[model samples]
Target chain A: MERKYWEEEIETMPRRQLEKLQVERLRKTVEIAMGSKFYAPIFRERGITPESINSVEDIKRFPFTTKNDLRSTYPFGIASVPLQKVIRLHSSSGTTGNPTVILHTRRDIDEWADAMARSMYATGLRDTDIIQNTSGYGMFTGGLGIQYAAERLGAMTVPAAAGNSLRQFKFIQDFGTTALHCIPSYATRLAAVFKEQGVDPRDTTVRIMIIGAEPHSEAQRQRIEELWGCKAYNNFGMSEMCGPGVAIECQEQNGMHIWEDNYIVEILDPVTLEPVPEGELGELVLTTLNREAMPLFRYRTRDLTRILPGECPCGRTHRRLQRFQGRSDDMMIVKGVNIFPIQIEKILMQFPELASDFLITLETVGDNDEMTVQVELAKATDDFQLLDNLRREIARRLKDEILLTPKVQLVGKGVIPQSDGKAVRVKDLRQNH
Target chain B: MKTIKQLSIFLENRQGSLKRILSALSDQNIEIQAASVADTNDYGILRLITSNQTKAAALLSDIGVLVNVNEVLAISIEDNVAAFSATISSLTDNGVVINYLYTFSKDGRLVLIVRPADMEKAELVASAQGFQLIQGWE
Candidate 1:
């Protein structure tokens, strides 16, 4: 068989041997965590030591870290190493509020690049491929993360950093781009532009699509794959976990094989804070075992996903993660029923007539809370009967997905607004409306 | 039988969108001889038989409106009863399916713009019925 992994020894090592390495790394990581001022209190209170982590399971003793903690600490509060030693820093764009920052030393950068490279290899990218990167560069980790990995893999890199759809299409056609990396939302928007220009995405030179940085439903992913006529891999990561190299789908495309050797993955009950058994869904908690300058212990990523039960055919021993469902924080409870914006997005994708541009608004009038889904029709179809039929069908389908019938509002093309980076899917007016 | 070309501009159903398009056209000094809004709850298709086809299309497209030029038969008839119904009856008799029909009083006559299922059959029916099909709108 042809070589499959970037690091065969590490990627295909025996589970027992991998566990030994993980234990050793866990001990060192605890020491590294103790270096941080934020973790020092928890260490003293919990009586954590380098030897405190006797086995991998002992990591359960560590307390969880949160984005709010990172926010509270702000700049350099989580940094274990001195200020001068840190060479690079990446900050979350703070979709909710203020940005949470992460620092990386020279060694930390190499480790990050290695994780990204291994993931790129797992997704079947090669040095011979031409890569077009559309993620925003600077401050955000999406752009630089993939660019460095592609470059390290020796692929011809086109740093087409987001937006300017016309120019992006020009570059893709002109350069014969073989691989693309961007958020699923941006990729979906580009498909519309391709249709407008009479360009067939499937017939194009792009063979692989790397989608990450935002939560998307499986239906949305399938729509993008169908449009481009290429296989798309789901990438799972956050700014706290070195920005999108944490887990990625291998060629099997069943589940993402998270790099278990570098991090300890746990699915825990969000309320009880206890680990759920294999194949069950829960909040993803990650502990960075190999990162320097900053090390996280059980950082609550807020993303919801489950662990796949069986071993993958790809021969990688790392545990695989299911496609991220949605952010727990983004879920909206409507009239005693819980609904996710991605669930609404999946239902919207079922209708080809509706453009991908959409917004879900949650408002309360009187005593009841209503979720209003506003979307745009792909074409300016003025047939009143046809449009009325479409509206009714959308409401019916959405009601089927979420038990509560939504107030469906249809807009014209481009009326719901377009998302270039991470899509803003919800607007909550429960307090005011 | 001479058929004038019609321009269809896609407009969102929101308020002020049609006004914005009209202001853009008005700023360019374009004259509309006949116009109608084929609307739905979500969007509207504003059909126009302007004084100029190429100029109107270019003007709307420049203002970022999706504009498509189509061939539609415009009948210049007297403003009397059955003037519009007679033309509709002629097309129906000859198996010419009219997709949609809109009328506006222009040039001291009732101007009916007919979107037909088939152009050739509609023209044949109009010619056989002695209907005066204007080549282009005033």
Candidate 2:
């Protein structure tokens, strides 16, 4: 159930030893990237020699890869390895536009699974637990990535790829799923379904619920625990970054312990491209230290978070990162106040009378940005005044929580539309206004 | 007994816009007593009896939903008031503009529906000027 490499290097390595390993991996990755067709041009354009990059500190010399760079390269643009060696490819949700394609080799796949196994063990998941992976499978890395790790960890995995709430409930009851790997929002949705069906989620045998793919608040984490009657853990990783198990919340649940041996994480100011002080919020820049097929150097993740250095309470030497605040692109500025949709969502979920299905719309009325929270009512009632009460409660809550007043709307059940892939929780219609 | 105010809101026919209107009211703590929707191809009429009618109209107006207060009476009687002249005469004699009207009863109470030209003035007159307004079951 233990990964030998991770155990030997990550858990035991001292600060000096880990840095030495990172420098060695960084040097090798640079040499490999320089010889490849994709990264050779980037290196040549920057007028940097592969031999010049000897240590991890030399990573700053290379230009950071952004999502735009990935798109411009298009298809197999930034891939350092040959197409023949690439066994699998995972793409982003392309929510912003085109999906960023990520290629993986057999070795790379094994490393990913190993890293996930370490993450699972770090979070207290055992082989005896039946892991139900509710993340989407097909093109998304969530389902396949977690599925491999669960299997690798000797845990029985139910590859229940998202949706079908009823069947998922039946599987959890019938199969006795002790661990759940899915988004926190879906976990809450399932809890709601159980309530509507007159079933108690607390009475079930689910022990741990692993949530990822979306940013969630502490309030949300507590709510998920209250709903499922299980400890909810958060993992932070993107499809491009090797999916959910890149960093996992240990038993302490304070912060996600980053696998420093595989990935060198740096908190950098998004505008200045300079390193921020520890515990300060900045964009997460990651350098894949050991990625053979595609080793990214200082890849701009655009994920806002702070890095917490030191040994974890779980006895791991790797640095942990604070929970992702929100994506830089998703941060909405209304009336000179910065607002995150997750913040509003956390507030809404606090009310038992409210459903999880809600939408936040930002419209620019004149020069000011106006926000409208469209929440779906669970049932049909003749009480229109109850709707008014809910609206005022939301407005009051938003004013207290976000320091902004937004118009609240209560719609009929199933009135708000649903999305296929990752749910489109917020719609920015400011440009139209 | 405190009098409750009923509002007839005119909503445009669009995709999922009604929900937005209702969410606004629900957030404001205006409890709806009884409600019904009359829909056409162009627009829909949302009829609502709320515990706090003044607050509901103001909240709806702030959110850009056209709503107006109507002074209706809930009297304990059998059958609907077939004579419209009596209802109109009661308000018309007091310099009230009869904009539109509807009537329904609940729990053996006869409800008389009346909409004045100016909802604010109508509500003020109904409350302060001794116009009999409907109250839900005690």
> Judged by TM-score, which candidate is best?
1
lDDT by residue for model 2 over B65-99, one digit each (tens)? 65666455433334445434554564566677855
- Misplaced by over 4 Å in model 1 are A95-97, A330-433, B1-138
At residue A126, give the lDDT of candidate 2: 83
Supply DockQ values for each candidate.
0.14, 0.04
Calculate the i-RMS of every candidate, to one decimal place: 3.4, 9.9
Candidate 1 lDDT over residue span B1-118, tens digit each: 4788888776776789888778887888888887898765656788887777888888777765666687888878998768777767778888999889888887689878888888
User: Where does model 2 sit among the CAPRI classes?
Assistant: incorrect
Q: Is the docking of candidate 1 incorrect, acceptable, medium or high quality?
A: incorrect
